[model samples]
Target: MRVAALDDDVEELDLIKSTLRAIGHDCHVFTEGAALQRELRRETFDLLIFDWHLPDTTRPEIVQWVRNHLQARIPILFVTNRRQERDLVEGLAAGADDFMMKPIRVGELAARAIGNLLGNALKFSREGAWITCAVEALGVDWPVRVEDEGPGIDEALQAQLFEPCVRGRSGTQVDGAGLGLAFVRTVAQRHGGKVLLDSAPGRGSAFRLVLAQAPDAPPPERGQGEAPA
Candidate 1:
């Protein structure tokens, strides 16, 4: 795939380009927003990797420009240090396809790009398929569960479900890069958490990411109304 990466940090730009290149992707690196915008006007790309903060502009502004001016549907993958719920919501609202925090993991970045593409594909093909996500307190642990009503995994494939490049039998007909689950597992483990899966053929799947919470943490405050989309 041809990818365009934009970041102000030289080291980060080099790392991103090198990583993408190692995986056989042709990457064009940019250190400023204006240069990227100019390139976008003259060239097309399969994917875009961006950092939230740049020397001249912010991610939201660039995202807005892409959405409103360029009017392109190219998948965007954000690689940045802004790791907050509101920040994520803002990025998604501004039309980014995926977001990853700083200290990039090349393998996970590839997997995320694949996951975003696969998710869009699934949305179009799977009738009545939907996802349910929730965050719940499990004693001193908080488990985030993402349940999908798509075709479930077969029993034989359950054992290595989280292994890299191991896609379930149900996904054979679906196009994917087969690294989504593995990346999920990696993120969970890195946070001193564990990933749990429950599924059977014809039964939907549920993945619970159990992360530790501080013992004395206060309960979450209820909001007044629905937040912005």
Candidate 2:
């Protein structure tokens, strides 16, 4: 896939480009928004990797400009450190396809890009250790389910569901710094969807990422991947 990485940070740009190139992707690095827009006007890329903050512009403005002005529908993947709900929504509203945080590893980025291209959902197992995933969004109604036999969530945990540094007190080690819910929310919203949470003290929590269809998502490959285990 051909990718466009827009950021003012040179190191980040290099890291993204090099990592993407290493993973069988062609990347075009951009240091400014104007040059990116100029190129955008001239050609189409398979995917976009952008940042929330640029040298002189905001991501939402650029996203809106691209969505409103451009005729093609290109999938966008945001690599940002901002975790504020408002920031997430703004990016989603700006026409970004997804948002990831800083301090990210290259493998996760590749999985996300590959998943979006192939129409997949990336998640973790109940243990939160393995990368359990599924392809081709489920064609069911809203209020889906993510029920499992793992540790159940509580009200406090629900409030901190998508936040970082949250853990359950069942004595089992919970992995991650709380990037899952945030990532899930970002992915769901970008596809015109929402994430539903229903957790019990003993029963496992069911996180339903309810989403509407994208206007022009590529045809989904038949079921071949597994959901978060």
Candidate 3:
């Protein structure tokens, strides 16, 4: 993916650039809003990352400009040091798809969440079965759905599907540690959201990861000895 990142701080820009590149994305860094805008006029990018504060602009002005002027529905993410509720509101109100604090680990969280979902879908579904992935906007939440035409899950197992090391009856047929869904649940809850499953004996499973449009607070500290399931 081609990504455009704007930040006035040199160190922050370097961090953003390196992190994106490490995840196989082409990242273009800008020290000023004008430079980024100039590039946007002549080039295209798959994603945009913006800092809440810019030396020449107020909060989210560039984001507003992009929403107002651009025709494409590109995903925009805000990575900044600001943590106030109103700052989050303003960023989302200006049309950012997601908001996160500074000192981020780049795409690790998203990659892990979605990766596990897709991996499970592939594992559970029979060979050549259809697996669909989609993103939908729901009022103040974004839900990523992964639907698979696999042997549907039982209600008894669904209840404990997100629990660590828990698996369905069919789990024994598949090679897994039963940790994927648990990790997905943890990631969603940390963002003040949740993971939901829709399935039945005959109907295939659809896993929906719903995340808040903007974070309400900083991620809670993990408990001592906590680890991914």
Candidate 4:
């Protein structure tokens, strides 16, 4: 599997890299947040592994960043010391596919990695950590809006806001999984839908999803279920 490992601690990174290599997976390690962000443009990994804290960004922020910036439903794993249920819930809410505590579980990591690889290959299509599917109970028309802080789609291209594999040039170093957005776009179009980009350079982007009610979308159960992403 193509795995990306991010951590501020050099020694910890080395140990994780060694353990993963022993299992025979290609691992990419990044210590600097900006460099890692840049590298995301260049590569698409099967698994993304990182710490809960980073020099430049928090785990939740990085997760949210990926949801906002990339469309691919790449499985993300968190290796961190944040062991509280609240912490785990926060991480899960932020988009972590799974969260593992520190003092690393090498064996479990291997299993989870294999499982994530299989799970992603089998399905792997969605927008966020959890999918914002239509609520069957809601009326046909729903409140939705598209906001863009950039110049427009034209500027989105300039800013690398579109799909990674789209027309945008790879001038900026980015290690991104280049598959999700295309699916998002395709699915949205199939449903006679559209995505609104609420963003701008230095401002940020938020894409509002609006769709016709899905006759197939199941009703919400008692427990909060995972979103489609």
The order by descending TM-score is 1, 3, 2, 4
Which candidate, 1 or 4, has the higher lDDT?
Answer: 1
Which has the higher TM-score value, candidate number 1 or candidate number 3?
1
- Model 2 lDDT per residue over 124-179, tens place: 22434223233445554232343444455567657765542344523355443333
The root-mean-square deviation over C-alpha atoms between each candidate and the true structure, in angstroms, is 8.7, 16.3, 14.2, 14.6
Give residue 127's lDDT in candidate 4 (0 to 100): 33
Error of 1 at 57 (Å): 1.6
**Candidate 3 structure quality by residue, lDDT tens digits, 24-99:** 5589999888888889989987778888877677656787778777777667878877878988998898888777
Instruction: Measure candidate 2: CA RMSD.
Output: 16.3
Per-prediction tally of clashes: 0, 1, 0, 23
Off by over 4 Å in 4: 105-229
Stretches of candidate 1 exceeding 4 Å from the true structure: 105-229
Model 2: lowest-lDDT 10 consecutive positions = 116-125
Please report how far candidate 2 places residue 139 from its true position, in Å: 33
Assess every candidate by TM-score.
Answer: 0.52, 0.49, 0.51, 0.47
**What are the runs in model 3 whose C-alpha is more than 4 Å off?**
105-229
Where is model 4 poorest over a 10-residue stretch in terms of lDDT? 143-152
**Candidate number achieving the greatest TM-score relative to the actual structure:** 1
**Largest lDDT belongs to which candidate?**
3
